[model samples]
Target: MAGTGGVSPSQTPTLPTQPGAMTPGRIGCAEIVRDLAWEHTPLGPRDRWDPAVTATVELVLTSPMPMAFCFGDRFVLIYNDAYADLIGTLHPAAMGRPAADSFGELWRSPGIGGVVEDVFRSGQPFLEPETQLTVVRAEGTRPEQAFFTRGHSLVRDSHGTIAGVLTVAAETTQVTRRLQNLSELTSRLAAALTVDDVARVVLGYAMASFDVDLCMFAVDDGNGFRAVRRIRGEMLDEADERLPPVWKRLSDDPHAPLVASARANRPSFVPDGEPLRAVASDRHERRIRALAVLPLRTASLKGSLSIGYRAAHTWLPAERALLNAAAQLVAQAAERARRFEAQHGTAQLLQRSMLPEHLPELERFRIAARYDVGVDGNAAGGDFYDAFRLADGRLAMVLGDVAGHDVRAAAVMGQVRAALRALALTEPDPPGVLAGLDRLVTSLGAESRNEEIFVTVVYGVLDPADGTITLASAGHPPPVLRRAGLGGEPPTAELVKVPPGAPLGLGGRWQTGLVRLEPGDSILMFSDGVVERRGRALNDGLDALVAVAAGASSGDPRNLCSLATTAVPGPTDDDVAVLAVERAVALSRSATMLVAAEPTGPSRVRQWMTTWLREWTVPEPVISSAILCTSELTTNALLHAGTPAQVHIDLNAVRLLVSVADTGTRGSVIRAHTDTMSSRGRGLGLIEELSDSWGTDPSVRGSTVWFELLLRSTSD
Candidate 1:
């Protein structure tokens, strides 16, 4: 008999279980395991061990990978001679002990032990990409901690019963954390849109990642390096002029470390002593023990990033590479910030041009909007929102998003916005208008078919006379409607409820719905940017938005819009546009318009007035009077004031009122009055002679020219 350690040597099945010693390339651990005496172990001597145990041991010892197996129910620890050094001082002693005795806290830890036990019982495997293990380094030493990507697998006996667990692992603490820090560098820099934003990201990361005592960013302001930003530790001075510039400033001072690094275009570090003393502040001369400076030089940006340590520290090669990579990536983002800071005007123009010049404030409807751009340049974001009066006197509103955030994408957004406006002007309803927009966007993308530009849009029209909203969507988020009867817990916000439609450029049909509002009820339309986040369901963000908006029943229209748009709890990466329309019973009988600064040179106001009349289906004589008044007022403002004009028209059962406003005040009622032959200012003179009531009033921007006509009873 094999004395309970195994079957008798004569009865034991012959498997190639002693290959660890026979294998020529086997190393130290294998030789040690093969030669060590196992008097304390149940398995006894190696050659006399059971065939199953011997085979499992051989499989572990002969492999180059770090592997260990617990044999039998007692789980005796057995591992290859390899990894003795990596296993720390517990190696040789660990070979014969039980797993708990050898691994200390790691094997005894509830979280880790459960994993191993589960694999043993289920005959399944457990994998951990990175897990922490704490083990005693030596008999008297405290525990040493490390991270490993590890796995536990069941080692089956010859009869297919679970015998023990095989643990295969690789230590990855330093490497994994380093890569994570590197990835964080780019991700943090990606969000910076201004120099201040860049400084926050850079200075913050330096202190956290480098364990530095002082960190500084000296921007090169065209002339030379200026210490515009810095985070000084307790021992450092506020403004130490002794610190070196990024360029050749005070060149005679040869000890300038930053200038030297900038000139060399490489990283410079001083491990300790006098080299640091030259750069040290007078108050804390001895506090500076170590320093490193990395130069930042991209085509559009120049600066120096530096870190100082109060204690002595050597720059490891890996640490040095990581710092260099961070500086390089951050410098590129800084360059973008600088360029955007310089070219902000163009961006402002693009943004202004992308949205409606003004949102009309009429009776029965109140309007407000928020357009927040996520990127720096080309402020015309991928998202857009607009409201304008349609030909038939109803209010048409649009919300949309292009597929990307780039200058080209914003330009394309402008084109698509214009196309949608033109289509909405003539189309009968939102669905038909969306269908037209789909074909238009599809044709626009044909030239860049490989790139495949796409857009999502929601269009709606509101009739102030009845407080009704007809909305349509094409691959866009549905509009949210909230009903709150003058405060308290608002009702659950309801979606317009439409089938999902494909994005524009895909040639698909769309869906539409009609929403009727109560006194305090409001409708909100937004781009997905307002309600989408990573790692969460799309409906989760939508629900959060509705919850916030439902409670925003009592506030300024602007404030209500702001509250809903900023409902998301964290920073966002995409452009957001939110347009809110609330039923305003107070202004139901009025309409307003924003005249252009330059009236397209040749009387645009006349055409606009004629269209408004026809759209309202006003009596032919009222239409005629509105047209004549529009031509007279617009021509007077264009010829005399050379500035834009604003117009407001109001109707009641008794009369019709038209008011025109401009930047200039009434100048002695001068007009085309004197020049009957010339088509110049007949403005105030014509108003006085052709209407029932007329007056002039001063305004904040300039003056308002007003006129009113009595409507004869149609019944007569």
Candidate 2:
């Protein structure tokens, strides 16, 4: 009889009973099998074994492949040396034992156990292209996952009776690991929302997955393709490592591999550097031996992705497929980002056109406004702010938010803002203005077939004469007030308790709240985005805004607006608009002069101030003191600060205030002692003696020195 591989049964060798009794030439597991005592095994002594069984065992042990034979009913395990290495620590002792006892959990696994049983029962050969199993490769260590392609065939005895099953396995763990990495790349590409984002994800995946020496991504840049290349060991040239890789503009060489691939919408592979060196455009490309250029094709985008290795590499079919799939994913993401960018640009342009280009300037009140879009800059939000002069000389300020983040919402906001201005011209009162806006919004909603058009607005009118702001809210957050301290008290900030009414499109009555603002007091009105943060309560955000506003050192409306807009940390998910108005001290007259840095600057300022004060009629003594103080301040600013200064003079009912501000590195104002007799330092001395109150206000860049004189009752 002949065994499975044609070895004759008559050729079977006798088994050895004593150790080292086998042929000295046998190596590996062959030596171990020959020296084993077979009497204790299920098959009994080797001398009593069937001739066919002995022949099959000899064939398995002599083979170089990882092969195993399970004999008899218990399926006693017998394997070659290659099989011993495959099972790691489970070998040696596993010899002469049942297959189930040797493999442990691996033998009981669904794929392995069921297939082995089927092959044994049907006497058929079966093959599994790939199957996953977990095994302990070392003693006292955790089991690790492994993948393999296995083939199982039934073995026949000498009388042609079906016996046990034989198995052959080839590990495929490396290929399976690469496929897993490709799956991860697919997931990351789906989340990319911008062109630059897609490039970063693709290049990073190529570098990590392929271990390539160079990775490059190119995108259509109107005139040509612009490429961002990442090279190993080149990170030191980047100032910020967190930023995306450096970019280069490719020349208009159609012969270059990347350009050719993109133009033809195909992929090109170079297995050696000889061909690449002829068309190489740069030093990096010149040294690369293996390269792959894959075109990224999309309806709105034209680009290419390329990877290179320093040593020659054969591009396998599987690797080519994976690279092509990556390119397709990148192209889809790039298309989406292109569309978003186009829409976002148009929407933002439209939104800005609806807002006031410049705020109306008021003598007694300074106004400033700020606007910022949300983190998802793909859509246009509804927050808006404006300041315009009313017919009655009162300043009208409004900040409102429409409900949605689309073109329709932006259009409605424009309509509301234009209507607000018209209404304020006719009905200047806060309540009346809001009532008219409510009617307008309700009518708009009805026109849209009641699609739930929601809007919230806070409107205020400032009476410059009395320094009072009448405010009205329609389902909006209350305005915050930073009250200027009086009588040596620190400034305080608090939210105005305005009555909240129903939002627009819902019929409700609105009431006006009046808050009297003292000189230097500022009021801030903003959309809800200024006081709302993710993962935090609304009240906590509101309190944080109050703290930021109060902590500001200056009452300038511009500074307050800046601080309030940045009150919330991290990215904001909604639009923010802040409008700030500050009431200056009651001034009958004010004039400002830009003092030159030359020596003649102080004299010119003196002449200007003297002429202006005298023109107001009969203030000779006050005029002399004001001119002398002004000259001294201007001189000090030019000599010590080494910069031009601004001289501002304000005349009010009770006093005259003169301030000199300079933009320089110096942050403090010099104050000379009262008893100092040196002429060089007598400037501050004269200012101290002549003025009623003198002080210095330090700023971020420089300082402001000012002196006030209490006017006699006749000066006005």
Candidate 3:
């Protein structure tokens, strides 16, 4: 019989009935049983250890947990079921093998053997909380998946001491991916705006939402849905329009079930199908093997939202609800932009009607004008210009810009322009005109009950006789002028700055200044839009306009006006209006002076008119038709030309020519007639037939026939 503490050197090998059981004659039985099993064994089959204990131990040896035993200094290990499975049926042969003998590779692992030895020597249960290890097979196969986990001690000896280690763990490969998917979905939802943006976000969310291979979003019109967003990994390629139908499919036939389902605002599911499977056969290129479409409806617009997966996928009710919520947010933003566009159309119509049609003709100046509205939809700006004849024979020209860009500003602009025109006609001078304009503005403010609005303007009255213009500026940019010269080219347009005054409705005394408009000088009045552009400073925009006007041709008023407006390339970002005035050129030397003439015979009138031209420095043959036209005019003066029978010629150094004028009271009129043989009325009619331009003023004593002919300077 073997003693509990140490088997007595038994002559005959007699096995004890129970190893750790208390028997009367057992040696060290109480101590051995107390330390090993921790309980005394009874004298029955229930208390006694079973004969199958060795086999059970052998079964436990093949478990996945590492199993080993240490008695004194020796280490004995039996590979567990998982380890034996790794070795594949060689486990029984590996029974009782030492750690060094069976797993020579594990023995060479840095510090592992030493850790086990320290556990054995120290008698303290050893634990390895975490470790990283590499396993190399003697057969030189490729490395297997590495593992990370912890191991603890198992004690099995008479004395309490560390005898073995056991460990249990789980792999983290799948869990890491779940966290990444969650992180990606959170990032995309933060900044989505448009339908396209939502679709892109949905593509990323759906792919990561269920951890699928790929995801796509498609939008549908009435018929069928087309893929608008397709994502695979991190790359997003813009959709190609030139691809074949199979490449980007949307069923053309309206009768298709998918199309009908989407049009009805119902979710349609497309699983493995007869045609769909064939169409989506390619795994990498195709977006998904399964699809779901939801119709999006908000107000008048209708579209579809689609979600798909490359793998055979099934979506939960929760997933469908999440997608539907995201779709609604996307639809709301799109509808807002649409409403903004519709309102902008109405505002533009009102803005266009408020602007003036034409500029009134000043006495000795040629005026050109243009007005351009902005293209920024629905929002109207307050920019206006008007030129019209005043009651006092002076031409009143007004240009202004309201402070804001809105329909209200446009309405205010119209009221201001109309009131200014009326007031300018009634007011005595520029200051009085502005003072009346201020009262109108204050009255408008009171009518609208709006306190946060104001306007800037430049008002002027041009007297072409002296070629002097009186003007006042109220918080407006100064006009520019390009003066003409006889021998030299036109000088750079000078900026005609005025002292800033309070804007309209802000009570302040306004001062007026007079500008001398020499014969060929050009005057430009414009709103701030021409000199304040986006990405450019006010000074830079002004400088650029000056340069443009320097090179621009002062031709027809309409063309010059167009050039000035186009000179500042927009999007001006604001409304623009410009008015230009230049002196008209003279026709001939005699037309530059006011003279007297009387009719006697055809030769005498011609010679008198000819000698008058000579005195005015006119060459002989140069006045050929002019001479005949003068004879006709003199005959008409004696016959029909009314009181103050004098010819007035206006020298327009701007166009380098003259305009002829006369004052005729009554009974003198020029009518268009094709008959050439008429005698008694031929004189006045003949003047009209030969001149470049001719007109009559019945309100004055006589009328004037103005013709434009080339004036050759002596230097030329």
lDDT, candidate 3, 104-213, per-residue tens: 55444444455555665664543332334333332335433334332323333112223343222213323223222322232233233234445555555556555555
Q: Which one wins by TM-score: 1 or 2? A: 2
Across 1-716, the per-residue lDDT of candidate 2 in tens digits comes to: 00112113342211111122223564578777788888888878888876446645765675444678787777888887767756665667789888788767656544655667777887667655554545455445554554566666666654456657776665553443443444344445555656666777787788778889888888888878888877766433111222333457787688777777888898999888644576676787788989999999888788899999989999987578667766776777678777866876676667777888668978788787777667566677788898999888888989999988888888899999999999999888888888898999989988889758989999998898898888889999999999878985888999998888888767788988899889978999988888888898999888988887787655566667667867878667888888899887664587899998899999999989987777766367787888899898898787767789999887755567788988763434544454534323567778878876666644434557787776763344
> Model 1: what TM-score?
0.45
Taking all chains together, each candidate's TM-score versus the true structure is 0.45, 0.56, 0.39
Candidate lDDT values, in order: 0.63, 0.73, 0.52
Give the residue spans of candidate 3 off by over 4 A. 1-296, 303-334, 357-378, 391-394, 444-453, 463-468, 484-491, 497-500, 516-521, 532-541, 551-576, 581-716
Question: Which candidate would rank higher by lDDT, 2 or 3?
Answer: 2
lDDT of 1 by residue, 1-716 (tens): 00111223333221111122223553566667767787658668776765445545665565444567777666777876434444555556777777667666655444544566676777666655564554443445554444456556565543345667766555554433443443344445555556656776676677666657777665566555554334454322211112111122223234656555655677887787555466544544347678888988887667778787777889876567567766776677788677766665465556656677568867666787766666444454678888988899999988999888766778878888888788888875877887887777877787667447879988888988788888778889998888755454535576778678888878787767778887657888888988887777888888888888766524224435666666776767788888888775343355777777674733666666667766766677766766677667766655545577888776644456677778753222322223242223344445545665544443234456666665653334
Q: In angstroms, give how far residue 457 of model 1 lies from its true place.
A: 2.8
Better of 1 and 3 by lDDT: 1
